[model samples]
Target: MTEGLPMAVPAQGLPPRVRIHEVGARDGLQNEKAVVPTEVKAEFIHRLAHAGLTTIEATSFVRPEWVPQLADAERLFPMLADLGGAPDIELPVLVPNGRGLDRAIALGARRIAVFGSATESFAKANLNRTVDESLAMFEPVVARARDDRMWVRGYLSMCFGDPWEGPVPIHQVVRVAKALRDMGCDELSLGDTIGVATPGHVQTLLAELNEEGVPTDVLAVHFHDTYGQALANTLAALQHGVTTVDASAGGLGGCPYAKSATGNLATEDLVWMLDGLGIETGVDLGRLVATSGWLAERLGRPSPSRTVRALSHKE
Candidate 1:
């Protein structure tokens, strides 16, 4: 088990350790217009693991036509098979359905994730099905994955607000989350797909979920920085007993289905804040910054992480 800092009571009752689920390799690069080379993707994941990120989301098994950038998932998984030898490290692939799950299982993947949407508009636009239909699609996938003893995660997008549907109600978000949880997902990540969530909104949604008997132990938060509220909302979730957060390296991802959405919270930025609070994440800040800087060259732009920019003198 990863040891955290000595427990210090904060006024907000936050946990001493926070698990930063690194999503840069998959989520961050998925929306990029240019295709990143498969070898580069492998190197990036290796660097992230070296930076002390234990749970790195490596690639998605979606159809190439949908996400051409990650079309090399099959090629990339084999390159990462060596890293899985470390008991502390996990490389999870995003599997859209049973076919995607089959591709991952054939490559020896032990962890996989399924995605759903909270709002009807996003559900239809992204998955080409209604919210219930998407959940139905995930049921068999999650069941088969668990039967194989592979860890399964379910993601609920647009939990706070939606672009086409306007403000999403707390009840609606809870309903989808409950269904995902009941489907045998080991964890459920609530996403601010368009990044319109505020601290108050996060608190309200979490509180309601808690009332509905969804324990925080099985929950994670995935926030986007579109409105500059990602960190603040994360702090709110932490205070509410959420210990897992999903962040991208260098603040690299945006939802392609939501044009108005911006990048996801940067792992470097999240680490900086958690370090300041004396919360342990077992990640090396300096090395994480360097990794982002290295990726920036391939991306042809400076990293969006303020911590990386500040430390690199790019400010």
Candidate 2:
């Protein structure tokens, strides 16, 4: 947690803290057609930190061929390593495999995330492997990360729907999530990659997971705004006691594979909704909006955050 920020304990006694993982640097910049300059990426990260976002996904360690935009991770992470007068924040990079992990570790990454999709077809298409094969690949990587004493987060993409296989089976999602949890992931982020999840779908899955005794503490929600349901789905997850939700600054991301999807839930929008519900996020709304505006300008487009738009208009 970022220190010195005042805690917001809800008057109604809601859990006083929720983890908001900022993925704008990696996930947000990954899908961009135009290469975001290394200096620009660095400044974006600095603004995010000043906005009180404690956990920011700094970059990805994948091969340049896979994601050319983040090819600069090697350099970007090193520059950010010296930020905030001692790197007080948690900066996690996405590592696709052992090679990616090696690059991330070389860049002094203390934390990393691995990607996996729940549906077999989706996994094969996105990761070029079956669901089981994907898990198998992560086993060694997770072991190595644990040996290094680094925090590992598992990303389960297409948790709700898939382009090739629509409406993923509940059992399939549960099986994969349980496998990742058993593999020693500190957190499992269930992604609505295509943004097809509803509040009911979220509740149903959580209910089933609860019955199976999967700890909700290790769960996080990652939602896209395809059908404009990301915020609604996030609210449902919050009701189920899921305290961690992934959001991108300015909604600056989308699936390069999943068509018609917008991006991760906008951080400003998510924070605004949480604040209205009297939930605690430890994020300054004005600073967050400013950061979003700055990034939106960098991207040369308008921010997709409705809350940001409304607040800025009022001001």
Candidate 3:
């Protein structure tokens, strides 16, 4: 739906236009050691929108004690209300529970995301609740958000592997994913939180979801680059008909709850592949690369994205 962007006609299986859900502002900065200033975070979102990102996750409404980095969610959303000169973008904020949802709604957030885990250990560790309890908490949040005419996204983490529990079964992943979908989530993002998923794992999980009557159109893939297979796993998902892919600009985040998790798949890296394959994403690779570089300076390190490094060198 981005202006001037070509649509991928589902040629061999891949969607013509892949929707890149930019999670840099929320997911990317949440794991940083030094809290990025609120103004810098707002500017980062604006720049990403200017670079043609139609859906930019602005911030999370989680408790400040839980994620101190994104504590300014209320302040951040107001700054994004007027995107300066960028395209009209959907800014989604993460809400951990009914309380978080209340805060997001108070800020006039039209879109929000709720996170759940497939494995019990992670559910307990990250959320301090069992998987069922976590889903129970999200049920009301999702229902209330829908009542408010807001979009709700559900994130299922550790779909392939869990640090506390190794090698999660596909059926378990499907069970959790289905629960989220049944709860009326507009979309469900399957996350490889530990980044241990390979292409084969991706294909198998997607296939099982499809077999279970969960449409790929309602699913998104969020991968971490820890094992260096994020992009490869993403390509496999695309071949399986997934059109939404989540990435962080500059590869700026890791899972605090998942000890071994690394930064997410970089937006610039994904855009480079989509551009080369002639898959329309509406992102300007050059501008995305620059945006990553700009954020990297604030993070006090160079971007880990291979594409960002390669493009920066060329420039």
Candidate 4:
């Protein structure tokens, strides 16, 4: 399909609203070669809140030795803790295991994210464990978060395919997702880790999950734009009743393990599509674009978002 192709969006009368989890501040900038200042990260998140993003993945509480970019997770949270940008906004941090979860909780994090891979090799490369082992590691973390009354979101990576082990099995993805949900995760995000998913692949997976009686309400979709199919795959998810979508503003993230993977779907483009569908994201498209452009300039590169480029040219 061509860029910005208009399609038949579901009627506005649909019962549920799609919730977008904006991850530009953390995931997008983490892959950047240059270091983004903590203050700038805070401002970026503040602007996103102003644009009506209620759920934002704020930062990662991982070791500096691995991802030095988000080493300021502790410092960043406290700085924005009192900003009061949005009344019920959710700021989640990526917490791999006990150590990361501890740091997140120490910083007063109310929400923590745990991600596991569908493919064993990708799991090993990304988290240094097998798929089962990775899920097992989260057992304690999820329990602790539940005890503290904190929100926990689980991410199943390589749901569609893996760079190391291509064409991930649908059963594997479903298994990991079910495991996370069983462990008391509030939501499970199925990721197209290498951006190899097509609308058909997405529909098939959704159907399989539906057949298994998975709770659609607790499911989300995370797509990358590697083959220019992120939005298409998102539309497929919407058709399957998935209302929670994850995107990075300005198209700012990439998979370090998946060499050909592009950034996450652009929030600008996703908002544009949802707006045409009369979906209520409560996000102001113009302000979101402006903030994305500002960061793109700061990073000294053009944005990967088709909507951003088109809108910028129009201006």
Candidate 5:
């Protein structure tokens, strides 16, 4: 395929623009089997910002032993301190607990995310705590973040399905999402960690969240493409008025704790769809593809993004 833009065809009732929460530096890299060098990771984030991804998730403040790939969070965050212009780019970091929150706050992190789970299995596997226990742990963290006047994002994983458990109920997801929103999260990224969600499931969950007083304005959708449903699920969320969508640069990352999970929705692919639909993301497609290509080269693997494959000639 040629290195070109997609045809513009506007979609009805969709938002004029979408805020892509780029997660390649954090979520994508953390799942890597090998530890990526800190210098290289910093360069990747810089490239992502240069590619016009305004809100890039810089790194996770989780314990080093828990996610070895992102062990250089302290060293990496400073490298991106000057990654912007007119509208300074937003760099959000993930914090697993109060200790993690302390680490981030010390680094002058203005935005932080607290990760939770919709199911007991994922909560136990990822956080080593029960669902209620994890929420209790996050309460203090979220409260502290809010007190500091920082933007807090709540990531509720396994919203659609859990590998250990089967299909997840919508009400169960809503219960957890409501709890997170009620706990003072500025935004909530509903995660389909195992990628078992369909469009119908996505819409149903969003509706349930709305009914439970979790408005669509503060909602984001994070979908994995394990069963080729991420894009479809994202479109469903868009139709339901969700504007913030989380995606990895090149379909990079899966749940480190869930074996059945696959890569996230590719930023390039998402941009391609939004571009074709005449929706604005402010991302330069060619530049974004090249950035993913550069990261793919450093990792010694081709990008999983179809748009990247079609637009970039790998060496």
Candidate 6:
């Protein structure tokens, strides 16, 4: 265990304990061209829980035709009723609209997330509606979830850049983010959907959001490694007092609508960095590495996580 560990050197001006929101089971596998069996998805999530990931996203309640890989959301989610008896673990799922929300609620999903885009192009491409129209659609979904006293997370994609629209203005992102926050979202996960965000851009966005009355305490960051800036952007967000981060196991998924976007920030890699900084993530680095390696084997490809590759020694 020590051989693969990093020397703990606590950093200043960073959150003491960062909560990693694991998105592999939902975001990662949703883009798989080959359908991953429902049993494999359940076992994969179980493995993630055993590796000490407390907030593993279980699955999405989107239309089966839209995301065929996750078509078994009905069957796959029920299998995770017991997360190896891990107490206080969160299993959030994505809900696109009221229908999605209804299905999730019927299945007893307590923590749900709504995916939105800052730009009109992505909103239309992903949701087939204008930005305002999509927000209108999500309004009821968020309200219903909140009315049920369930935790709601708003995922604002294209916060940094959009492939179709080019660089998304910080103000544009702030507007959409404020709408989501005002709509009873308990937390908001800022997404660099096209993976073009830098550290400075991340800090500025956080600052702008703060200036717009969106407190730092209710914020999370989600980045991609397209330009190799996800870790840097994450560090910037951490420095800005963000404690929640969205990462995928094995760096699995990208935006299906954005061809230029890449895989998410790998959870194992993020844990390695957090461990080095002495930031408590409650994740066992050795176990996380092994989990990614295991998933990679099942996915029929090597993991994109640098830490997993370096530690597995068989890549």
Worst 10 residues of 4 by lDDT: 1-10
TM-score between candidate 6 and the true structure: 0.98
C-alpha lDDT values of all predictions = 0.93, 0.86, 0.90, 0.87, 0.91, 0.92
Candidate 2 C-alpha lDDT tens digits along 1-315: 123122433545345578899998889989999999999999999888888888999998888988899999877887886662455688998998999999988777888899998988778777899999999999999999999999999999988898888889998899999898889899999999989999999989988887777888888999999899999898888878899999998888998877766788999888877776667677888898888887778788888888777767766
**lDDT digits (tens) for residues 20-63 of candidate 5:** 99998899999999999999998998888889889999999989
lDDT of 1 by residue, 1-315 (tens): 122222333445889999999999999999999999999999999999999999999999999999999999989999988898889999999999999999999999999999999999999999999999999999999999999999999999999999999999999999999999998989999999999999999999999998998998999999999989999999999999999999999999999899999999999989978887878899988889899999999989999998888888842
**Per-prediction TM-score, please?**
0.96, 0.93, 0.95, 0.94, 0.97, 0.98
- Higher-scoring candidate on lDDT, 3 or 6: 6
Candidate 3: TM-score?
A: 0.95
Give stretches of model 4 more than 4 Å off. Answer: 1-16, 83-86
Task: For candidate 6, write residues 214-307 as lDDT tens digits.
Answer: 9999999999999999999999999999999999998999989999988999998899999999999889988888888887888899999998
lDDT: which is higher, 3 or 4? Answer: 3
Tell how far residue 272 is off in model 3, in angstroms: 0.5
- For residues 58-106, could you state the per-residue lDDT of candidate 4 as single tens digits? 9999899889899888788987886434467989889989999989888
By lDDT rank, best first, the candidates go 1, 6, 5, 3, 4, 2
Candidate order (TM-score): 6, 5, 1, 3, 4, 2
lDDT of 3: 0.90
Q: Show how many residue pairs clash in every candidate, following the order shown.
A: 0, 0, 2, 1, 0, 0
Q: After superposition, how far is residue 52 of candidate 2 from its true place, in Å?
A: 0.6
Best by TM-score: 6
Query: How does candidate 1 score on lDDT?
Result: 0.93
